[model samples]
Target: MKTARLCAGLMAVLVLTVSGCSAADQAQNPSPTSAAALTSCPATPLQAPAGNGQAPQGPPMNELKVPVDTSTSKVIDPAGAKQIQCGRTQLKTTDDVAYSTATLANGTAKPLHLDIQVPAGDSAKPLVVYVPGGGFSSANRKQTLNLRTFVAESGYVVASIEYRVQPDGATYADGLADIKAAVSYLRTNAATYGINPDKVALWGESAGGYLASMAGVTDTDPKSRVQAVIDKFGASDISKLMADYGPQIEQGFANSPNPIGQYITGSPAKSLAASPEAVTAANPVTHADAGDPPLLIFHGDNDRVISPSQTLLLHNAMTKAGATSTRYVVHGADHGDLAFIGDPNAVSPWSTEPVVSAMVDFLKATLS
Candidate 1:
C-alpha cells in the first residue's frame, strides 16, 4: 500500500519526457512500468530538459559596433629552468630519547634524555636545541612543546634536551656538559633524525638560557658548538645578581634548596659577595670572545625574576668581543611569561608573531 501511494504521488509530480521515436517503434520499445523495475520511489526530483536540438535566428547586432586588434598570449619559456617551492612541513616527534649517560657528582650513572620535533621529511634540516627554565632544577623537556612544534613545522628539527638540575647534584657546568653531550648525540645521529649537524642552534629560557649561552660561548666542539644562540631573560652574571637587582635579593636565595644553590656553593648571594670559582665558571660573559656565534636575546622590561639588565650585560659583552648580537626588550613581560614569545597559550601550535617571527628570521639569516 505504501509503495502504491508513493508511486501515485511520484506519478503526479513526474513530468513526461520527450521521446523522438515513431509510434510503431514506441510500441516495440515501450518504457518499463516503474512498479515492475524499481521497488522504491526515486529520491531525486525531476528536472526539465533544457530544449530540443534547434535554434531560431531572431535579432542581429544592427547598430552597435567596435573595432579592436586581435590579442595573442605569449607562451612562457620555462624550459631547463629550475623552480623551487617550500611545502607545508609536517612534524615527527620522539620523546624520552636518552642522548647520554653521565656519571654524577656521587659517581652514580644518570641518563640525560631529549624530546625531538623533526619535520617529516628526509631532507636535512638545521637543528635547534631548546633548554627549558627551572631556575636550575627542573628537567621537563616538553614544558613549552607547543612552541617547539611550531618551530619544527617551520622547517627545522628541534630537540628539547634534559640536563643535570640542582637535585641531581649538578651545577651549570655539569648541565653545560650534558647539553653538549646531547648535541653530540644528535649530530652523530643526524642522518637518522634528518638534521644538518653543521647548522645547529641553542635556544633556552631562564636557567636554560644561561646554559645555552655558556655552551655557545665557552665551547668550540665541532659536534656541539652552535651557529646561533637565543637567550630568553636568562641570568648572565650570578656574581653580580645582588648589585644588579639589589642586596635584598640575596636573602631570598640564601638556602641550598633554591635553584642556584644546588648548582654551586652559593645560592646567589654567596657568589655575589665573594664571586666564587663556581660562579665564574658558570658565567657566559666570563668567556665571551669574537669566536662566539650570533646571539638573539629577548627580555621583558617588567621581568621581576631575572632582571632585564642581564640581557644588556650579555649583549654588551658580545658586542665588546666583536660578536654579532641582537637584543629586543618585550614590554610588560614577566620572567618566562608568554609575553616573551609574543603570543598567548590558548593555542596548540604557537603563533608566528613578533617573537617567533624574529627567531625564525634570525635563524634563517645566521644558519642559512
Candidate 2:
C-alpha cells in the first residue's frame, strides 16, 4: 500500500511535468523520468522491475546510467614511482600497478585502478576500496596516496577507483551509484583479484567521503553488502550545507573546476535531494546498527571547505549507535593538508602518518 501510494504521488508529479514544457516538444520528445525519481520515492530502496515491465519497485536503472567516455580521461603510469609490497610485511619497490575500467550508473566507463602494496597472499586478506574526492568535480586517483600508501604498506589490498564528475550531469547521486556499482563488481570478482569479499571496507575523501558514508549507512537490500566505511572530512548533509553555507558554497562554485550552472542541474531539488547534510537521515551515523561494520574518520580542525562539525556529527552518531568508531582531528590542518600535519621526519611527516597509522590499525583490527 505504501509503495502504491508513492507511485501514485509520482504519477501526479509527472502529469504536471508535461504541462510545464512546450506541448510540441512534450509530444515529440518526452522528458524521461530519472532513475531516482522512478525508483521508490525518497527514502526507499532501489527495487528491480515487476511483472508489467513498468518497474513496479521503482525507477529503471537505464534512466540513471552513465556511459564511459575515454576521451576525457588520463591514465598516469606510476612507472618509476616506488611500490610497497604487502602481506604483514611492508616492502616498498618501484613497480607499476595494474588498473582496469568499470561502467557507471550512467553506463559511462570509468577507470578502476589500484596499487597493490600488499599482495593479499593466500589468506584472502581484507580489502580496502578507496574512493577519490573532487567535490564531485575536482581531483583524481593520485591525490589519495597519503592514505592509500599507508593501507598498502599495512598488509592489505587497496583498490582505488575513478568515477564520473559532477556539473557535467554526473550529479552527486551519480557518484554514489558509480561507487556502489564498483563495490558490487569487486565483490563479484574478488577471487580473481585476490581479495576477501566478506571483509571489504569503503574509504573516501570529501564528496567521495560523503558517498562512502551514505553507502555504509544504507543497506543494499539484504543489509550486509558494505562491511565498513571510513570518511575523510566529507560533507554528510548536502542540503544543510547549501542552506547553512550558501555564501561559502557560492564562492566554492566560482572556484569550481566546471561551470556551476551545469553541475547544479544534476539535483533538480538542490539541497533537498542531493546535498550531503540534507541526506543525514540516511547517513551512516543515523542508520548505524550493531550489525553494521565499524567506522573510522579523520579530519583537520582548520578545514575551511568542510567544517569540523561534519566529522563530529558523524562520529557522535556512530558512537551512539554502539558501532566501533574513531574520529581524529589534526589541529592546524586544512583540507588535504595531512601532508603538513606534523613533524617532517617522522615516518611520513608530510602525509599525516599519525592519522594513516591509526587508519591502518583500525582496518587491521576490524577487517583481519
lDDT of 1 by residue, 1-368 (tens): 43233222222211111101112211232124432322111111222333773322111111111111112111122222221112245567788999999888788998889989889877799999998776565656756544565567778999998888766777777888898999999999999999999999999877788889888898877878889999876778866542344444433333213345446553433423344676667678888899899998876554445556677778888989999888876544445423212222211111224556677888899889
Instruction: Show where candidate 2 strays beyond 4 Å.
Output: 1-120, 221-224, 242-265, 268-290, 338-350
Which lDDT value does model 2 have at 23? 17
Task: Look at candidate 2 and tell me the lDDT of residue 298.
Answer: 68
Return the TM-score for each candidate structure. 0.69, 0.60
| Global local distance difference test of model 1 | 0.62
Instruction: Quote the positional error of residue 154 for candidate 1 in Å.
Output: 0.7
lDDT tens string, model 2, 189-230?
A: 777666788888888877668778877777574323677788
> Cα lDDT for residue 215, model 2?
75
Worst 10 residues of 2 by lDDT: 14-23
Estimate the lDDT of model 2.
Answer: 0.50
Clashes of 1: 0
TM-score leader:
1
